[model samples]
Target: MRNHTALTTFILLGLTQDPQLQIFLFIFLFTTYILSITGNLTIITLTIVDLHLKTPMYFFLQNFSFLEISFTTACVPRFLYSISTGDRTISYNACAIQLFFTDLFGVTEFFLLAIMSYDRYVAICKPLHYMTIMNNKVCQNMILCCWTASLVVIVPPLCLGLNLEFCDTNIIDHFLCDANPILKISCSDTWLIEQMVIGSAVLTFITTLLCVALSYIYIIRTITRFPSAQQKKKAFSTCSSHVIVVSITYGSCIFIYVKPSAKEDMTINKSVSVLISSISPMLNPFIYTLRNKQVKQAFNDTVKKLVFLLKK
Candidate 1:
């Protein structure tokens, strides 16, 4: 972390300049942030306490909920503060830290989702060996690999960003400190850093997406071969929640990061990003709980236990 940049503080322009809009955004974001935290935390708590959820699938779901919480926490609260207090300036180091964490959590999530897909594949395609193959130890190691892989992808570009000289301008277009907006303000040569960022994004996206795609392919093929229609329905139901999440995660990201026309609509991109960080996290818990019988049952059971204790 070298202090080579001339400008130490960058002003974020935020989503809009209207006072009315800012108030609306603040209220909206705060509500969603609270909901996101509560939802993900509920999932985490349920996974921890419910014996019925003591499966490899719920293990990954627990971690995914954690990642969603972490990812949203990285940016949402700060933006909310800025909106309410009318202070949009973030120090250079603070901006860098935010960028690093957001990327770390975001990248790790892609891998985690892929891992979840593989878990589903194993459960459906190779049920007899699922327990042995995806034991607790293996799940823990796979999560560690997700973090390690994310670091490998993000660290190089960030190190290069340290050498960026922000003498030109300090006003960022987006609500939060993100890679592209920061790079746009730098006076130094950003070609290499930009390339590396693109490479990292592509690598994470392609590799994880391929894993998810292949896993589902095999899963679908195996499910189709099952003799009983009831078996097929149950198998698909087990995977539907994960598939919906994967689609939303990948689709929004591809629109923002991989689309050729992304640069043309920065405002739209930022708005879509808000949905990704805030709305998506808030929605995931409901998606899982509503679609999953085991989770709903566990929640009901837990509620009953709490009610019984309260009565005593």
Candidate 2:
């Protein structure tokens, strides 16, 4: 740990300065954070307890739900505290820790989404061998690989960021300890780190994106050749939720991170960041459940059982 920093604590300039706006932001964040946590938890519980959802698709969803909870919890709750207490100061170590977890969870999600797309491809394109190919051990190994690959992608850049020296400015432009904003405020020459960040981001984006694209291409081709319209509809329906989620996750992220001029507009970027950390997580469970008959049926069964237990 390179502890060579004159500033021990950094002040976060939160979303707004107006007290009225702060109240609104606080309420909004609190509501979304609660919903996000509850929703993701429900997904995890359903996947664990519901026997019908023991398949590879739901298994991947369970892990993705956990990542959603972790990714949002990493930053949203702290910002909520900052708003409620009117204190925006985060210790150096705390900020670093937050950055690490956020990056780890966020990066892992990309790989996981790619893996889910592949799962769909196997189910649709190669149904006969799907069971054997994506068995319990195989699913677990794929998830483990996602985490391991994400660590490999992020560790180098994060290590370089840890050595950054902040000499003068202690006020971060954005709400969280994001890598780009932190690097902007550092006194160190960030040319190398900046390149590394871009390289890593590109690597994660391209690799996972290619996997998703290829998977879907094969899936769509397979679906088109199905003998009946009913079969085609069923195949496409299975993939709809994953496709929507991938679009939301990738679209927002590409706008925020991939563009060269993204940093020029901090306000828009911050709002999009909030959506990524809060809104997306809150919506994902609903998206999966609403479109999914198996999950919905499982939820209804669980509800009936709980009601019966309470009545007894």
User: What are the per-model numbers of colliding residue pairs?
Assistant: 0, 0
For model 2, how does the per-residue alpha-carbon lDDT over 187-262 read when each residue is reduced to its tens digit? 8888888888888888899999999999999999999899999999999999999999999999998877775522
- The parts of candidate 2 lying over 4 Å away from their true place are 1-5, 261-263
126, model 1: CA deviation in Å? 0.4
lDDT of 1 by residue, 1-312 (tens): 244555678899999999999998989999999999999999999999999899999999999999999999998999998998889999878988999999999999999999999999999999999999999999999999999999999999998888777665789899998887777767777778877877788888999999999999999999999999999999999999999999999999877776432234578889988999999999999999999999999999999999999999
Q: Model 1 compared with the native: what TM-score? A: 0.97
- All candidates: TM-score: 0.97, 0.97
In candidate 2, position 97 carries an lDDT of 96
Please identify model 1 stretches exceeding 4 Å from their true place. 1-5, 259-265
lDDT of 1 at 90: 94
**Alpha-carbon RMSD to native, per candidate:** 1.5, 1.3
